[model samples]
Target chain A: MNRKGKLWIIILLDIVLGLVFFKALIGASEELSWVYIEKGGIRPDDILSYLDRKDYGTVAIMARSYRIGSKVRDEDEELYLMGEYADLLFYERIFAEDGQTEEAADFEKRRGEIRGVIPEYESVLDDMDQGIEKGLHGVTSDE
Target chain B: MKCPNCGAEVELLDEVCPYCGAVNKESAAHRAEMKHYKERSKNAKEKACGIISENVALIVSSVVLVLLVIGIVAATYVEKNAFMFSHWAARSESLQKSAEYAGILRQYLDSGDYAAFLAFENAHVIPAYEEGYTEFEKISGMATNYVAAMNSIENVVLFGEGAKHYSVDTDISSCQRSIANFFYTYERALTDMEGDPHYGKLLDMKGKMDVALRIYLGLDEEKREEYLESSEGRQKAYLEEVLALE
Candidate 1:
């Protein structure tokens, strides 16, 4: 097998521990829920920040609801890919290294726009409300 | 001039059929070219058809070959795991059950209702301590074999989905068996206690057995009864497929 295949087999090995027990028990197919640290060193705080700024309205509010939980959720299997913002930073850095300045700058700018909108605490909610309105209207707000 | 003058029956020298003045040469030449074009079109289509047919055959054969390989791999994986499961079934569950019960007895010895501790006394704890020391002797003896089964060529091939299912069934059952065996020994020791001072230890072992047995046989009563009845060496029937003997 190729390197990628070998890596996948290793992952499959770990997953088997969970699956084997379930299969062995036959009728007792209970699933255990786990909170795992995400790969690529993407801190929970960083993910929460991204979630908050990525959307407005009830969607953003839902993000807020999950933010307080000590556990972090990752949709993708966080196998050994390396990067900050977890794995994404690796790709982003690659973009920068290839001297794709314009693309990288645009990428960082959009990211900054998200960081700009999502305030840290509820104390800034009044200001965020205006930002949300601006976002919904598809206009830039001086506020 | 001759064609214009002739009103009937004209030769080629007269330019056209005298019955009707027409461009005979031009019409005949056009028919020749049209015939040639149609023949060429047919040949071209057949050549293209031949190319497409060849490619289609190549693609279909490749797909069939790939599927065949995958089928072989899948079948091998399943067979190996099934064999392993059967092997696990052949062994009695008692060994594993004992180890686990011992671990629990150790725990309750360390913690739980304090009155529960003195109950173990010299009579109860000593035998369990000795049995716990030796209970995994079978599995321990099989350790090399287990490792071989996990690491050898046959076992290596039995990995992925197959490995997962095989290991899980055997691994959990092994744990249950080890634990159950330990508890049974302890329970047996408790029975030997004919007098007082050991009452508390007896109750401790009893309570621990109640919880552990319920778990070992499964949480439900029906399942527990089924396990107790169908255990290996018993004639009671089992729902699982009978594994092939070595």
Candidate 2:
């Protein structure tokens, strides 16, 4: 081809490649934004945040909501289960302290049922029980 | 034409006349014209080569730019699907360790820790549909619904505790939806497990799930049997009553 013809072809290719590059960059940016920004919704740790504040009621509901929202994976399974178990035990104590025997019994029975399912975690349960008895702090708190 | 000196016949391009040994006058002019034409042709050929060489560089650079753009796009695609690729890769690896996974899965099931079983299965990306793991399929399926039901009921019990943080009507509706979904899935699972070899294990899970419902949602054995035998509308009413939504 002549010089002019070759130049025009190169210009055409440049336009096409530029558009493709622009599109790819846009898509990548959108994906990155979603992964970093919009994906930052509730996490299981959010439940623990309420626990840190000693908001047992909020912690209980948040833990349950988190469990229903996310799947149980082995990495987080113990945390999830223990979070719920601690919430149950916490409420059981509160109800008993208030002399609401029936309500307290219900909570006790619920925790027992949970214990029945995860019988192998006796040591963890023992720790949780001790933690609850020690002034009702967070489930995993060393204090 | 004839030679100028001897008037003998000679070619225009000849410098000498063969017949009379004389010089040809037209020979020098003819050679000069040929030389001028050759020079012009050489100049034209060199000009063309220069243009092509310049454009070849342009073309090569453009191709490199195009390749670079494609590479960037491909890298983005792989990045976006990194989780999917990793999950698939892990599943392939798990397929090779089917016996080991099956043993672990059996241990979870035998221990009545359906939640752990599910967690292990999912975390390892076990190939549940493969031949070696197919035996656990029915049980796992049931276990999924059972676990979901258990969680949903727990949500029902806990929602009241956190009423200050949520809208009562919306949370109630959400909990009701979860319960209805569980019952629907539970019914389907029962049908699927009718003749399954894992039916006994499923029954045991169902028993535990029943106890949970009783303790949390206050649905006793008779109430649960009635709920199962009732129609869809009655089931809804029963849930509302049991949940104290009335």
Candidate 3:
């Protein structure tokens, strides 16, 4: 075969390999990204006031098994995290009052960002809670 | 014939087999009974754990029942024990003073002042010298319960379910409860210190008493017998020592 033929064969192999690697990377990233609901870190004061004022996250779902509000344990950090996020969002009023176009745009943007992050973080809630049942079996966990 | 050494057909006259030396089969069933024994061992351990849990449950229930009886019949008991109280109170008070000093000695353990604990023992309080002997007798009794409770707790730990059912499985907690009770009684002993003419000494006594009370309260009895035994412990020797300190 001519040199051109060999070069073309090499290029074809590289293209195939590149596509395979890209697909694998996407598959792995998607698994991690969608694992849990994510709420960013809480501000201590925001949480304190929320706790003080008796504001809480509306009943939410956890671990595919529990209903967020009444069924799950009150002390679960996942619920607490959600409650804090909700309080901040409620306190700040992400949605505008007057229905102005400019205010609504900012509200929509903020809402979109929070919506994007949520499922990735809170996943740890059920994992930590059920970790022992899953045979994490840490020394004191049974106690 | 096929040659064993090489897996090739050989002439009838060839002496050596060319292929691998294959051993004859050994049966796959060896140690089957050993496995049964192992399973039985595991079952036995679990049974033992169940027995431990029941024992712990009985002990805890009995203690609670006794306390309930005491609370209910407290008035009658007080009437009967009244004459004993004056004598006991005097003793209780003396023990409390000793405990107060011991409280300071315990602090010195954490502060890394072995000398402080040692020094406080021999120091002459205006009224008495409750020093080393009384303190030693008191602690030795606490240590006995601390050890016994700890041993009993080990059995409970074997019963994983029991630990979950009884939050007070650890010996440390029993000791801690004793210490807390000890502190209360210790505080009562300080009634004598109130009559001291020196304001500074009275204030100092007050501070020590408060600190002692707080320490007793904060002790994680699940872990510390010394703290729990500070009050009223199950041991008679400890009680005797505490009675002397008062």
What are the per-model DockQ values? 0.01, 0.09, 0.01
On a 0 to 1 TM-score scale, where does candidate 1 land against the true structure?
Answer: 0.20
| Candidate 1 vs candidate 2, TM-score winner | 2
True contacts reproduced, candidate 1? 0.00
Tell me the TM-score of each prediction against the true structure. Answer: 0.20, 0.49, 0.16
Candidate that would win on lDDT: 2
**C-alpha lDDT values of all predictions:** 0.34, 0.60, 0.35
Model 2 per-residue lDDT tens digits across residues A46-142: 6555444433434444444223233444554555565667666754553454344675686678678778877887665665565444322212212
Worst 10 residues of 3 chain A by lDDT: A59-68
**What is the CAPRI rating of model 1's predicted complex?**
incorrect
RMSD of each: 30.7, 13.1, 32.1
Which tens-of-lDDT digit does each residue in B128-195 have in candidate 1?
A: 32444343222222222222211111111111111122243443344344434544554555555435
Docking class of 2: incorrect
Q: After superposition, how far is residue A91 of candidate 2 from its true place, in Å?
A: 15
Judging by lDDT, tell me the better candidate of 2 and 3.
2
Q: Considering lDDT, where higher is better, how would the candidates rank from best to worst?
A: 2, 3, 1
TM-score of 2: 0.49
Listing candidates in order, what is each one's chain A TM-score?
0.25, 0.48, 0.28
Model 3 chain B: worst 10 consecutive residues (lDDT sum): B154-163
Once fitted onto the true fold, the runs of candidate 1 whose alpha carbons sit more than 4 angstroms away are: A1-143, B1-110, B113-166, B196-199, B213-217, B221-226, B233-246
